[model samples]
Target: MADLQVEVMGKDEGVMDDYIGKFTLSVTPGTKEVEIEGTVFKIVMGTFWIKIESTPSQDKHRLQFPYLFDGPIHYSRHYSPAVGLLTNFNDAWLYSTFIKGVPLFFRNNFQLWNRKGPASFAVRPGIQAGHRLLYARAAGNAFGIIEDTKGVVELLHTGAQDDVSGGGGPNAQRRVKPAVYTYIISAEDASFRFSETGAAFFVDFASKHALHSNCAEVVRYSGEFHPRPEGGWQNFGDFTPDDPVKWEFMIDNNSGTYAPDKMLLPEVKELFEFNFPGLVVRALDREDERLVESREACRAYALKWRGVRTDELQLHVREGEVTLCRRVSESGQQEMKRAKDNFT
Candidate 1:
């Protein structure tokens, strides 16, 4: 079992606020599958409060909806967990995927801003309204820049790459670079006024020109600012849906699942258990005598009892417990369950 702790902090009206969260992943001793669970807590008015939590079910796991903190004009966050992804539903939604064999986790602090009134940070990208205004260029080896009518914003690579290659033609072999850029802004001013303005300016510029269409990939608008006396570049945060244009920008450029080869074995097992309780019970009972046996022997017994080839079956054993899985025809599974139930 691997454990990870996540924390987020911010300041409001000179008062400090914080959130603490943790998640754990437990892997079977000899298998690549894992079970995940976690919870999150926040400090409200100087007291700790439970925000979100997850509990394992008899046959599956359920993740609780995340809560947003409302306190002293500070940052707030939302969370959601799906089949293989966990997301921080903030203005700049951060998410991570859970691949079968990979252990993943993330933690970060963001200075939140409210986009409700005139004091809020807002921008109008020119693309939606048909205007050309953004520009980009690779600068030496340190970073890049995205500039507009307002000013120049430095950008860094987030190590995330996307290929926008279209139909093959004369330029089929051309090397295409990723379009995403990390906008760097100063956070010393204690507000997102400067960063927001710069982001809006860049979006407007990128919307009008074909040469900078790649700029559309710049869905994430992050910054660097001084949080303490010893100043260093830290990611303040990214643009969220508060800005209608930025929201549409992400929807148009950054929405989709990247897991093309994700496995469906677990999902199939769930379906089988849901519809074939009797057959599943019989199968479990068949292996009850071998419950305390070794993995190799138990697996062999399960295979022989099921009379299914290895490719069609998945036998998982952990701590003297055995689970039988196989790709049975939907009708066959239903019939088996029905037959078992009627047998006595």
Candidate 2:
């Protein structure tokens, strides 16, 4: 196995004007994973840019283009232990290595998608992950979706929070910002077949929380897209889906809670009906007596129907605990209830 280690430093230096950090990146050719461990020495009141290039020429291009890249890369961060919850300082920084020799492609443009006010919707083309694999996130919650020739499958959902505020102090309400998220797709993914030529790579966005019509607001959205090498990297200009996919959430006022639903706006529904004649969207009602009895069971049922593996789906009915279950049939709502009861 081939291995390479390198040290990375932040761009700026002044104690109060820049970020001082060190990142050690280790690349393992066998597993195709890069492990990054580092420390964030100091961060000033400015955004920091970290770039890793294969050659000096590439580094120069990165400096000039900033957003363009040509290589396999993975980025992840861990809190700094030295900071220990200190304000304005992350404790640590950790990143993963590249996997499968797949070079991650990034879109140079930094665009923001916002839907001005409450009860509104916006549709945009999502990134194409070659094989339907898509990485998406909203307000810090990250998840992946796999949509093959068969249908769409929701991968594991992570960073689920009961309260949108994330349990901050009293000022949390004031600090609340509209959810802004992004998605990435691999241009080489087979899923690009579903996208229009030249506009094959894309990402979609939607606001999770409804804002008052009277309130003035805007949520900034920006991120990079990883394109596969098979097609090289095609710059199709800005992303605009021919048939915009709408993601709607099912919110039951009676329960005062919300969950993703199969509901689609009339126009979006019509577009899907025409484009994907075989597409099926299951409607799950929060008011259903059986579902209300076991929210986890409801989630399990919904996820199973959507092709999520039983082991991949986890439910936490209480604090600091987890429950797992096998697949249940549509007629086995009772079985799900029993599983929930027994587990809890």
> Best candidate, TM-score-wise?
2
Best by lDDT: 2
**Candidate 1 colliding pairs:** 91-240, 126-204, 133-205, 134-205, 134-206
State candidate 2's TM-score. 0.20
1-82: candidate 1 lDDT, tens digit per residue: 3333334334221111232333333322332322222232322223222333333333222122122111111111111121
lDDT of each: 0.21, 0.23
Tell how far residue 110 is off in model 1, in angstroms: 3.4
Q: Residue 35 CA error for candidate 2 (Å)?
A: 28
TM-score of each: 0.15, 0.20
